[model samples]
Target: MTTHEPVQMLSARLALPLVRELRGLGHDPAPILKELGLHEAGLRPLEARMALASWLRLHAASIELSSDPAAPARAAARIQPDAFPIPLHLLGSQATVREGWRFSAPYLGVGIDGLRAELIPEETRSRFDFQVQGAPLGPAPLAEFFMVGLFAYGKRVIPSELLPDRVNFAHPRPAHADALCKFIPCTLRFGSRSVGFEFPTAWLDLPIRGADPQLGQLLAEQAAAWLSTHEPTPRLADRVRLWLARNLRDSDAVASRLARDMKLSERTLRRKLSEEGTSIRELVAKARQARASELLGSTSAPLDAIAFELGFSSVGAFCRAFKRWTGCSPARYRAEL
Candidate 1:
């Protein structure tokens, strides 16, 4: 995503499990990593922000590799947010799903710009809408992931088993619908307007098992501090990419211009970037890919305009380059978001 979009990170909290799950099913994960251009090292850092492109490709590869239509739901149903509690501790501190949902803003926003999680509370019932950001992806896997993940997570923290009164999905039911009963034991409805859970409002106030008022206050303060200082002092390559993103609208987005902006000779810039295992051209492309994903994922910007904004001469040119970078055309990429 662009610097302007919500900050996104790939907590092994979700990513590693998909890879491990695939392995558990007797599939190799090496090809999945290679297809997505990710290293085993990238998954090691729990707090590291993954490339959105890689994240998307990883999901696609997992589903394809495992040949499991229900991979997404099972992956989410099994993820334990409490294991990586930098932000989840924020949710665990709350007394109710309603309050927990509200406190989850920072965590969800930072982690999930590709999907939207909303809680609509009424006098008698509440709606938790987990809508995909763009058009439907796959069997609309994330829809199952989020809806089941939330309930599974709640069941972990609350003293009693917490089940949604019912569920709704934007996608039509797949052949594997029967398996959903094992994941979510609730009234399930498919072909709805959105994917989410519906429950009585009374449960919103149900006490979480280990909530502490003092700890809540402490974690809140810590989250605030972490957010403020989280963006680290940029390394040489990161600074170069930032400069490229900011200047992509201008035609002066080449390495000479980047070198000048960094107050270095082109040769020195090249050497420095080589040390970082990237080139100016590679950095520029990375920036453009990220900005492109941000524009498509969050806005209804025209393709030609986004192309121009990324310094492409025309929509055709942008489409070609984006496909090379991501293996999908701009429209296809946007549609699958």
Candidate 2:
């Protein structure tokens, strides 16, 4: 079979949850990943870019491989708000659902390539629309996953009894339509021109559970930084910065490890970064400083926890570094914010 070339790219993190759900359903995701030239171990460096085609193929494969016709919807419904990648988390952190969609719509490209979200206000209802531009829409399962995922997330964040007045699907009605209804529990309109939902205008003002404006601002900054690297061809320095930013908590961010993961020798990686007017050390520091500012400005987490999350050896070390970056202690920075 001729494989389709990816015309656009998205964060690999989007596939991790879906792949986990497929495994839970007793389907082997390895074959599908292999078929699409993805790493058999799993999509790694969660922030690294993957072909949009591969993401859609994974959805299609889940439907084909699983005996359950509702596999995709089930998987999406199981996704908790905290399990969402940073972009979606950014959306949920807004003070209200309407504000969340309004703020997050532009940054959708940070996670899903070719996807655009629009919030349209009506007199009594507001419609949120999802559209794929500059690429094929892929299979029906892909559309279902997007729609269901959003609704499921909304239910978790919106304080009121959540139900869309109307849900629209671009794909034709499916044989397992009943399975979808069980999860959605609202009016479902298939064969629609768009994929999204309409809810009461009043619901738009409903407070999001655990909404934090500070955290939302921090996440928005991270999303903006990630979106900057999604150009047709990003600079090496920008790519390295993004990688370090995403992996600071889990990975060491050492030069050797970064080079190995990026498929380049240490010397070559250094040379390339130098060509781009940066070094590994400089990029690492930049990532640390940016994340430090975000954590300090956003949360009341103790300095020790923040230090650990930023991969520092100790609170003292992080404090010293924070002072170097901003001429003040982390606590002081938070105080000022």
Candidate 3:
């Protein structure tokens, strides 16, 4: 399996939910950890992060062991204010949903549970979609946690009224469903294809409460320290590539710039990339090529402007690069998309 880095040390916000659930079950969490291939030693630390796989396994085990209808709700109640929520808290504290979304995204391990999230931009709006490819152990807590967190998070970023299209629970909500409605304002649908949130594209620019440059700097410093010691994720390259692609409009999308933000020297950054069998230039090109295709297909951004954003010196250079990458002109690519 292509292992991605385990999530950075989980925030107290995220782990607190699971801890509370285990406490409520009157069951020690160690056994659950054992069943899920995690060590009991991990629980000794307050800030330790584990594999997303272990989390899902324990979650599934909890549902099966508890077999109680109120399990998910009870677990969710552990998420009170002043919790870490892992990277989410850091992300949430950002100045805008866009910043938070981008920052928090790299740490989420949805694929560990056979799920993947996509941020799609439609003509009129953008949506965060969670697509599932496997059976959820109960999926109730996962859904509840995500829904409630998103609502609470929205309050810090966008207005609360703009909830998701619906909470796409694969199964129906529990008997206590009415109380769930109080958390978010959007329609709640059961048995949908996946769980996702749809918001007005304009909200992407909405400022967040924690968008301070100083705060961002602090977080960047702390996060870099945390990531450096953790096991490297194979998907890190893909992640870096995607982030760069999405933020291509930003001038500081280069490796050295990102390395600085990540609190690493350019030499160290290249070494890490080398360890992963990839390089900064390769990732940049990969990201630019993917983004160019998307922009060509989705927006009317001028070709020259797009080229410049991708760090090309001229339109002809971008065309040459694009042809080398995909054997097609930007115009043709847009037409195809």
Candidate 4:
């Protein structure tokens, strides 16, 4: 049986608390959920998963309706440990904060997709970085929520003064920055390369409150079993395609960067792609073509802007490639549409 990795998805239960919190704050979440093609009933099941796009849309809509910039953070604050999905339980069971984060980082994808957590040990501090993949960052709300929610979860399990010294956000600072600080209680840095926080390295050894080695072992086994059943081993080619599509806008979609991101040597990456019946160049071309079609069909963006967005050297270069792919010029293609 051919198995594929989990696409951009998160457990539907991840959104339920936010929905409840929204309703509590006098915003009717039902209409928003319906508009997003989500039913509250569907999100109740532990096994139910929703597209990461849908999750971002839901958060964006909630913030818009409430007219509150810190709505996501507030909702996250209200989420108790028990309210979280199974994957989070795996984190809480580990012996120490560092072990919990490191051990549970791999399984977090089972509960929340499109987010990667890396625990980096620095000289005096440990940095927990959150990288958003497979989706747009979506107006800074989810990024805010994840950072704040991490601290909140840490406090529950670590039983100490568990505040990060600094927090970083990839998005620009919002007008209601103070509102976020009220929840995060840290020196917040905006316009960062990534989203995460820095805390005293000594905290890594802080014991998790009420941790049980036996329980941790059981949860680890369960998490592993759940992962194997739900998320199949991913194909290398699919991962390469995703990386190319996400990074193409930044003009960082080169083969070397891709191989490095995949943790493979360039020659090994090439050989693996050959085994998968594809090439990085072919995938990049297809990604550009697909993005071009979407832009042409959906928006009235200028060809030069589209070219730049697709990381082409110039409009002429893009035009040549488009014609080669579609057997027609971009102008003619748009006119025909």
Candidate 5:
């Protein structure tokens, strides 16, 4: 007889709060639950993930129902549980910070939305870029909440002698600046590209004790069992979206190009996209239309220039595409606003 080890799953910390917020906004989450085929009891603590697609839908719906466009920011501030400063108990005997980071990455997603970690190596020091996707409701308040987590986690694993090289963010808030400096004695740059950490490359070379033979075997067994039940790959639409989002400025994002980027043969890519309820051409058109709207509303560039920039052959062609997308000509779109 074979005994299966129970798969351990952690919910993103704010998931519960977001659910409550949705209900508070007078929206019945039951329709969403039914659509996702999720059980009402799944909202209980310690439940396994109810499909990544389901979570994504809930996130999108919550944002749409929000009166403020930046609702994510506001929700983020109060998202984490009150018992928030969860200490980073060393996962085994990992000596280096990088190892600790890798161990925590999957688990960190439990509380964070749109969080990503990027590593940039430099001669003297390296930078770890932590970027969060989508602007939430209250930017200032959210920054504070995240800082609490960052500081608490950093202070535990990383020694006090070594400090972050710098802190960079997308918004400027004096209160946040003070709180950030209180924990990290480093320079803070606001309105920067993304959130990241900088440290010495030598740090990576530090041996990780947590990778001991015993722990390695244990973790491997645990991981193997988990993979047996999970989907284990990116959904088709998500892959296409990520690919196009990264390559939108290229202006030559043909289906073949996307196929190559995704490492799938063109025919295979088409088949997979078809299975996912979309096609490469439709995806590209959707991307361009969305980008066009954003640029038109956010920038003061001329219509012709904007069209040309988005890879249109001519201003007239762009106008036609825009009309097809939003049922309004570019001139009319501009006139209405």
Candidate 6:
């Protein structure tokens, strides 16, 4: 059996708090869930899993409905550690931030494939790296949520005032600069290589106030059992498809760039894809086709704009590609929708 690609599934527990918070804020969660072809029943059991594509759509939809651009960040700050499906009590029971991360980081992948956190020790400070491995389509909300969520969850276990002294994002600065300031109290930086946080290394060794070593042991055992079943062993083709979706806007994002992003060489990437009986070009075409269908059906974005988003230099070029892919023009596709 192959390693399940993280993109194929996302923990159902991830989206509900955001949805409920939105409902509490007076926005209907029904439209966004329906748009993503998800329903309340699917998110019923917090431990249940949902498609990664649908999870991305859920965050995107929440941002759309939240007129405030910093809404995701605000919602993330409000996340309670106790509510997470995975046992975060394990972290709280640990002695220090470093100990907690050593125990927690590996299992986090089981929750959200696209969101990975790295705890790096530096001379004077520690870096907490957050990233979405592939294409960075509409990244503001997710990035904000992930960064803010980390701090929110950390605040629960770490004794002192635990806040990021500096926060950075791989994506561009959002238009709602003032709102991000008002909502998230951190000093924010944008347009970096990855989303990350920097805080004093001293915080890493600071003793956790209420460590429950006994309960921690029990939870760790349970988590190990849980992970044995939920290992992140994604298939090669599915992983490629996800990468393609992430970089659809960059027309020049070919195999070499993709390989480098995935920390594989060009040769390895090719060998892996071929082993699965698909090539980079074929998988990328699949990504564009899926994206085109999504935009055409759900959004009223103009044909030219959609063309640019799909990385076509001109509307004519996009139209031709769309025709080749679906035997129809973008306009016709949208009209049929």
Model 5 whole-model lDDT (C-alpha atoms): 0.56
Best by lDDT: 4
User: Local distance difference test, per candidate?
Assistant: 0.68, 0.74, 0.60, 0.76, 0.56, 0.70
How large an RMSD does model 4 have?
A: 12.0
- Using TM-score as the measure, the top candidate is 4
Ten consecutive residues with minimal summed lDDT in candidate 6? 130-139
Off by over 4 Å in 6: 1-8, 30-46, 85-87, 132-138, 234-337
Structural similarity to truth (TM-score) of each candidate: 0.56, 0.61, 0.50, 0.65, 0.44, 0.61
Residues 1-337 of candidate 5: C-alpha lDDT, one tens digit per residue? 9977333223333344556667878888778767867655666533244444455566666778875433433444344333231112223235566665566454333333334354555455666655443222124434444543455444444554456666566566464365456555677766543455556677665554334445434544454454455423446766676567556656664777888878999999999889878898788777778567545643567987877667788888889988998899977776764
Which ten-residue region of model 5 has the weakest summed lDDT? Answer: 83-92
- The CA lDDT at 336 in model 4 is 77
Give Cα distance to truth, residue 319, candidate 2, Å.
Answer: 69
TM-score, candidate number 3? 0.50
> Tens digit of lDDT per residue, candidate 4, span 90-186?
7777788777777777777677654556565655766666654422233476677766766777767777876788887878889989998888887
Per-structure clash totals for the candidates: 0, 0, 8, 0, 15, 8
Q: What is the C-alpha RMSD of each candidate to the true structure, in Å?
A: 12.7, 18.3, 9.4, 12.0, 12.1, 13.3
Q: Which residue pairs overlap in candidate 6's backbone?
A: 3-233, 3-234, 4-233, 4-234, 5-234, 5-235, 135-246, 135-247
